[model samples]
Target: MSDFRDVVILLPGITGSVLANAAGKEVWAPSAGAAWRAITSFGSSITGLELAGDDADDGVSAPRLVADVTLVPGLVKIDGYSRIENYLVEHLGLERGANYFPFPYDWRRDNRVSARRLESQAMAWLKTWRERSGNAEARLVLIGHSMGGLVARYFIECLGGWQATRALLTLGTPHRGSLNAVGFLENGMKKGIGPFGLDLSPLLRSLTSVYQLLPIYPCIGTGAGELQRIAAAAEAGLLTHVDAARAHAARAFHQEIQDAQARNARDEAYARNGPTLVPVVGIEQPTVQSVQVKDGRIELLNSHDGSDFGGDGTVPRVSGTPIEMGDAKREVYAAEMHGALQNADGTLANLRGVLTRDRIDFRKFQRAEDAAMLTLDVDDVVLPGDPVAVRVRASEGNPRISVTLTLVATGEAFDEPLARDPEPGWQQGIFDLEPGIWRVTAHAEGATPVSDLVVVAAP
Candidate 1:
């Protein structure tokens, strides 16, 4: 444990931290059984064991305790950023409590609130370390995933976290924002296999964190043309009051980023004195760019081609990879999914390199794209009658690459000139197929062909 050099804090993203009630009951945590109950119990106001801050009327209050959650007995571990914790403890030789800690907060609250709490907790930890270890020179490093990254940034930039922080590293974080939040706001949340799949829409309506994640750029729209402003629809009575609050929060966060960018531009000293900002984002994954809500129906505009506008199933690359300020370094990984970014070998190597100030051999890790890396972006599963969009990209910067999508089950191929959306390398159309396992294969000229198994579930 003493081999650890500096204190490190691991901040989890939305639903990444486990929370318990006053009575020690698991309130919010991962469980296959809990997820099954939530789905089956259709009409209950609250389903499953996720009762985080149930007494709080606003749903943005703090949790009673950041409790430890047990891993499922038999199932293999997958998804979330928890594995990163194990890697740091076991492989990196970091000791829990002594040199490492997990900063778990109520994710539904405003990022500013989380940032404040993080600042307070980190300061306490640093003080204790200085007193006990006699290492007054000891500084702290912050590693945040997804929403946790945003919270850490707020603490460093706004809450004076730079005073004690050595560096700030973010993984798959939406520096700008994510369009998926719009989907949640437009259509109530859909339960997925992971925490993102749990239908938390009813409680999410009052969540400031969700609203803060709305894309800073104009992308989502309604029947009255593209939403010109955040509160445009809500103010016009087209959206509910809950959505109006979300729009208000989204606009506020956008302004905050703009202000931060402007401030950092003028006062060069601000960046010079602050902690080093390192942002590592995932690319080449089909990420939703926009959510069009019309007549109470939602349409997800996903970036199928691995464009800069694309995302890693959650955060768009453009939003995740913001222009760095100060001496901040940015790293991009192709084919790394958002949920698994923290555990990916390439990402972990880059992080270790950054910490040790050593040069990383990129060749050691697998590249999602080769010399002419073919990047394919699409959902892993879709509902019957749902329009499946496919986006393909070549490292040579060719947008018009010859690509073919074949359904293995039915032996159907879509290789002709498909209809394009407003974006490049994007095509969408409905394929009539029975519910079963479907292998979607894409081949690009002069590039390695890639295949992804997609499930076509019954509607």
Candidate 2:
């Protein structure tokens, strides 16, 4: 392996980490078998995974491992991060568990708890690697996907991790926050797949991180320009689950990071040599751009045209774009889904560039200017033994496009070319995919290929 002494530590987004109970039973993980079980009896199957109180920020939640579980209690999500792990090992010449491994933490609690844990572990690890490799130049290269990005930033900015970090690269992270989070907290987590669903509102409403994921942007208001603060939404009875105190604290968490960053910028030692912040944004997918309060509940609005606001299907561009992202050294846009971004080709390439400083032809990534904005018609979550109906419609009129399905577990391609649909600007195909996570890709002739993730739940 190449003697690249840089210590690489990856952080997974919310739900990207695995959690177990006091009985040592793995409760939170991605499995087709468990997925269906959780779907049907989710309220019962996943017991003891809930937190103690609604206000995690009220006091430091020091839940013991398997007891209170208020601390870091999980691993790098699931096998999905393997694609990323393998890429780093192969390209960066790093060894797993030696210089590269994911920071596993309980995803159900306060993000500050995770950030603090990351601080202690990352600093110690960096010191060890520096001395072992005899490379004083060695520093931390943190790669966070989704909410994991937020956790990493909190460590780097809020906790003084900038001193030892070489770079902090984020993929499809909702920097501001996601309207999807608001939808989840407002209506509770729903599978939307027939009756096989979970009313996780009770469990979800108590999460500080879930409330923190609410859109910091102008969301809860009329479709018009008039918008109110999230705290106002709570006061007006627009929110059912999230309370005013939790909503304000969640927003404050984001502000704390920005405030810390500003302080670091003013501090000479950090200002001169701060960690390079590069957030890789996902584009060209249907996403929740805004929400409206209808009656007593909040409703999410997805303008499925894949605009900048369309974001990466979950995080809109406005949210993913860090408020303090002032001319980052490296910035890229990939046409991929929120779930698939961690392993997307563009994301991998950008990571390579950030780690090794290899000259990348950024023109290749910016071709969306000439490329068609493709919207893959597929659900983010699917049912077991169900025929997934895949459709692709391009912004440019009837364009020649191809569709393909690839199993994420094996990296095997199962191509299902489409036939022209009766409706204009669309091509369609149907495939009976087994219970697992599958990547659905739609390629337009002479344009960038757009993709999304479809998880076939288990029985």
Candidate 3:
């Protein structure tokens, strides 16, 4: 067993910098790689993992735990400057200049080479860290953001064995890949631009073709070629094997990636199969149309698509929680962009809880001035005099909350008010009224007011 202390490696997403900077003795900014390079031309005494070198035999071993925090293309970046990063740091007690893992390239390109390169680099780093730390039994905890989550899974399934690594905590990872890739590829073709405006390497094109042929988890590929495939699939209709292959390929890819990681690792320190998959879900506030189930698929209903079945303007709920490996845990939070997972306190708490497996009450760390509305549903219908209950949830400070129920019967109005609770979730209230149309308004004593409309039938 290595004597080295437990290490929490932070892996940054595409175009992401290390967690913090060098100021205030708190390292945030640029990202781990950039930070590492900037601090000194020479490497730090702190154990480091690099994706490009012949540093094997340096005593590195498998089963190394990882924590990925990389950015996804077409999604918001979570950096120290971003509100999401601030929220996560506060909630997770993360230091500004700590050692965290980061991805080597962009995941938006959907290139298997990039994925493979990242996996190889992470594996080497973990092996070396384990050997150097003298803790062969040490576990790896991977926290991936957006597509970085998928990359982490691929790594574990491809290399992690039971003897190495522990768990995987994915924040807004698209295991099945994202439909947005289709759009990106299409737009690129129209502009005569290559993948991200760079030429598509022949190997990359081959990988893309192979991805499409796979029975599961097919690669969306990068650039114009991928766009053509998407169009072909649509033209072939949803019934053809081509379409089936595309769908199955994506699923299979996730399964296979996981299966590969499970097959290669040592079985003692880590689980025999793939690392445990934990999905973090995001929701937007004041939007009753945030979630939807269409064509048997659960999606995040957002304003961008007007279909009540998209995502927080970028990631679809189906893509957000795509992996189906092992017993899984889910956490939901309020935020619009996928990167918001980093800043949403509730989301960060849940992530920390998963990594540490310790019980943490998020309510204790609540901030003052945080407020959200609570809507009640009674038998799938909104009706007056039907025991309508509403509550106010605040982050901090005592806010006088009131609920006013107006009954429009015989041109008469009756108002009833309720108290606000400073906790998360819902509170109940009872109301009985004469038959008529009723409008209910819930206003916090010192905050904004929210109202709902309900109708009651005459007996």
Candidate 4:
């Protein structure tokens, strides 16, 4: 009998892996000492140190940085992932280093390149599983979070990873793109009230992975208030004074993967005989839906003007759970924020729930229309005197969209005007309304109307 029946591999989100040097220098990974240094140093003076892996001069060019670094699976310790890895070993009764593995990678690199490393890891695990069981057909299970999910997808789709894997479960992966990455490139980090306030623009642009996270769809609008493709915006000179070479490189990488996705989706054999894919997405969290330049800097704004547009904070629900995976197994959760979904109770429960069953739901999903949906990306509850952020966004059509919020319980309604450029195209209004059910609607001249419901709960 085999000691290990099936292997479970865990992949971390962005910046979730730890990097250490022989001299005891640590970069990226969070620690008590790192936090103390951050509080004491100005800007990234203490925490902004770079490692060799972050260097893009390996002849990889602007967009696709060459993968010259090797990541050790055992040498990683990310806070959120460590907790979940422990749960798998202790609570799930999975043996560590035998049936369970945590895969850490250089998250700042291209995802497709990272997928090659994941392929190597999966093959080794599969070989071990087959040897232990005397069965050469055993496969592996992959649990990827954030960018890790993209890596897994690339392995399965483009690299024939489906042949060596059994199932894939992704959490908070941005299948489309994240606007926050664009914001980071444009505005950099807002100089917060602290000793560490510094311009993060230089650092954010240096990472090839951040450019990979740019929006793939036409959700972002240009200064002229027209929703255009990200590539189009870049070509039309929307983003200025940025790294053009890196952007081009990232764009080529994105196009390649998208073509791979389309090819896989069209393949009958891949769909019928491929590994099972389950996407668990979070909704009702306020995520950055759009970004623009304001006051000579980039401004990140929430979609639907901050309505619950359906995401876990960083990745929107629509982008996280891709339409391509509509027929695969799907799980939806509300109120789970980003960064902590790996260790969240609800996520764990869902993980167990999926494995306990042998069959997938195989639900068919349709691509949502541009104007068919609206979201009130706000909290469900608020205190009496708190300034509630009211934002509304549409799924499609024009960027010059208008919104009207009505406190249905009080029969009070008001139309909000669209905020000027550099701000998002949607309208945002802050009000201290009485606790009740509020209805928000978004409408453009040529698009259909959409609405979302929000509850202002008691404090």
Candidate 5:
């Protein structure tokens, strides 16, 4: 018999439990005090009837549903709690329990502890489920939201052997930490230190402080501290410091990116790259930038349908997808976000497709061939009149590719084009440009084309 029996585990994001309760859903909201209380009050019920039923195929079987695991910040009342909680409870059939684990609020405060706790909880649950079902081959699926996704990933990486996990799905999790988080942390810290006299509990302070400073950006090590250092240097009129900090963080971020890419390559390197774990899918909202002449005035217009980005308003499309240690695949639904994942309409339908079908839609990665692919490696300082060698690769197709490299110090584009062999391999060209942020564009002869941005240091 196939060891792949369907089983799903739901994990909620930050403040998800409180939101669930305010929504009047059956969620296990455990505060520190409440956990102690539960241990004392329900000591007997702790080992109560093991919730199990017949196999899914059995006519009398009740579909196995377990308690929802919500991440830290317990539960808080927020607007829209009723409608949102009711919808989730009705759809997912969440249960209340007493064994949920809690972690420090600040992700950076102590990642090691947080990661360990999450792994322990997940492993414990898996063990129990496996023992009860007596199925060594049962397929396990994890559904996580926001940071819950990250926790789930850490759990899989730490405790989930290749043979243990079947699939993982994340909604609105910041695999690559979001820039918005930096702002949130900074503001929270300032408030905690100033008005709160830093008297806030360690959990609250950490939630509002420490994790913000570490390099948490998915695959990139550009943490809030690094960004703050850059900002401070820039404010202090230390252009050099700003450049160095930016470069340092970029390199760190690039390392993680490269690592992720390498992992992806390895997964695709062979036919059976381990037990058939498929790609992790994410929903992304559509975004477009446009400028229009309104009443003879050039106006920049940025408009998004409420669901235009894949994230659920908080997480981006890139971060919400599950982290496959192998090949990475993503799907962007034009109008989807965190909450939209369970939509009954086409949104949830797409999710179901990803869950059932092993293939991913590739159109999300498609780019107009006319766009130029630019790659830069600045091993030395970027100074004015520095001899910079830039390499570019452009697709040989209609709307032929044209390249432009600009010096930020002077609003001047190099008078010459970077040598383009239009060959299959790397092509190199030299430019004497001043230090600052450089802009490179690959244009299709007469059409507006795509571009990439790079900052070069002043030598």
Candidate 6:
């Protein structure tokens, strides 16, 4: 009789895995020291990591998820994962390798490919765990952050993984896709990564996974503000690298999974046999809702879904839940960022709560369209010790809004009630820092709080 009966597998988003080459040379795994060196010549690295038609020539592959990605207690660490792996062991009381496993895959390939791989690996893993533990309660609980959730949903809905999966909790998964991805396609992948960003357009274009990230909704608008012909994206000047055929097929992949899920929902047998899917969506942070293409340039803009709800900085709140899973008995929202949701306090609490039946009430953290967004006009990298400009915004209707920055190192914090900005319906603040990592949270009256990570490094 094993204490922990479920096989809990954590699937990471794109870039969450460690990719290597044929000679076992790591092509992509941005640890602290490696990142500085990689940034300078990342262009050449992209060549090795690029996808190829022939598997024989495909040099890049993911060996494992970056399990060691963490921020140890002390020495002014950069913005790191919320320590999700530790949470499982300490808070959730689960042993690694016994039940908790991280499913890492080649994120550059199509999600369908990864989903199929999951179906096979998960089956074998589950069988082995069940036989060893001899526990009738043994099952599979999948926790997916970002794009990993898309892969999990595809497996459950389209590849028959639902037969064994008990629950799937998705953190900030973009069910309808993101405009940020559109921007990446318009430009290149690394152009968004950091300061010395390279335009790896050719390499990014070769990845089937990137094409599959195209927005499913009609988010593309013309310079003239015409939003017609949304799904026919290949014609969009911004998506020059992605051919029309690939664009259409990517949309079809999403549709196929959705259609399969609908059929399962309609089937009476599915109710008893299907897995429980819970989407932990983040809201009220800066997120890309739509894009306008002008003269071969893609510009991202944030807009509400007409319901007044916001989204994680990467995925719109409107696309948080798949249509099939929208009607879940409990609908919870958080104020975490897109990348950090896995280790977010609310997310971890919720996961623990779901397991022990003692989850925290996240209703207080709900973000309303009125005051649901906080924006920081800074990239991942900045001049060492530079003061970052922070912008906080709410719907024009918001009566008041405030900003708070908490030093992750010392837990020291300061709150600033922002003054109105020159732009209507916006407030601004300048955050002066002392070489460390900080977490910023925006609070508005009667609205859910919005929080994100900001790193201020020393020279």
Report clashes for each candidate as comma-separated counts: 5, 5, 62, 15, 22, 3
Instruction: Write model 4 residue lDDT over 311-331, tens digit each, in one string.
Output: 888887778876576565565
Point out the higher-scoring one by TM-score: 1 or 3.
1
C-alpha lDDT score of every prediction, in listed order: 0.66, 0.75, 0.44, 0.66, 0.40, 0.73
Query: Which candidate, 2 or 5, has the higher lDDT?
Result: 2
- Give all TM-scores, in the order shown: 0.65, 0.70, 0.45, 0.66, 0.41, 0.71
**Candidate 1: pairs in clash:** 191-197, 192-197, 304-391, 305-391, 370-373
Error of 3 at 218 (Å): 13
lDDT of 2 by residue, 1-459 (tens): 338778899887777766666555566655655555555554364544667764433222222221111211121123367778879999889987668867877777888988888898888888888777888888898998888899999999988889889888888888888877777777765443455545566667767788778877666675555677788878868776668888888889989998998888899988788888888998888888866776675666774222335688888876667887745534588988887788888889888877776445454466744445678889888777778888888876677778778889999886667888778778888788888889999987756688999999997
Candidate 1's residue-wise lDDT over 1-459, tens digit each? 355566899887876765554555555555666545434443142333232442453333334322233343222133655567777787667778887888888776677877888888899988887777788877789998888888888787666677688888888888777877766666665455543244566666666777888766666467465453446655665445336755776678657755665665466665576567778878888888765567756677774222236667788877776545323444656568776777788888877767776334443344544345566677788787875656665556554454455667678766643345457644433455567766665655455666677777877
For candidate 2, the 10 contiguous residues with the lowest summed lDDT are 67-76
Candidate 3 TM-score versus the reference: 0.45
Please provide, for model 5 over 1-459, each residue's C-alpha lDDT reduced to its tens digit, 9 standing for 90 to 100: 222233455555544433122233323234545434333443232222111221111111111122233222221221212332334334433322211222222222223334456566556665765565576555446655555555555555533322355666655555654433432322232212112222122223233212322223322112122223323433434322123343344334324433543454465432243234322333444322112222323222222222233344445544444344324444434344444443324534444555555444343245442233334433344555666665554443333345577766676885445455555544556666556777766554433444566666655
| Over 4 Å off, model 3 | 1-5, 12-99, 106-111, 131-134, 161-163, 187-252, 258-274, 285-310, 323-334, 358-459
Given candidate 1, what's the lDDT at residue 277? 72
Q: Model 6: how large is the Cα RMSD against the reference? A: 22.9
Candidate 1 vs candidate 5, lDDT winner = 1
Error of 4 at 56 (Å): 5.2
**lDDT-better candidate, 2 vs 6:** 2
Task: Give the CA lDDT, 0 to 100, for residue 188 in model 1.
Answer: 65
Q: Per-residue error at 345 for model 5, in Å?
A: 5.2
Evaluated with TM-score, which candidate comes out highest? 6
Report lDDT (Cα) of residue 252, candidate 3: 55
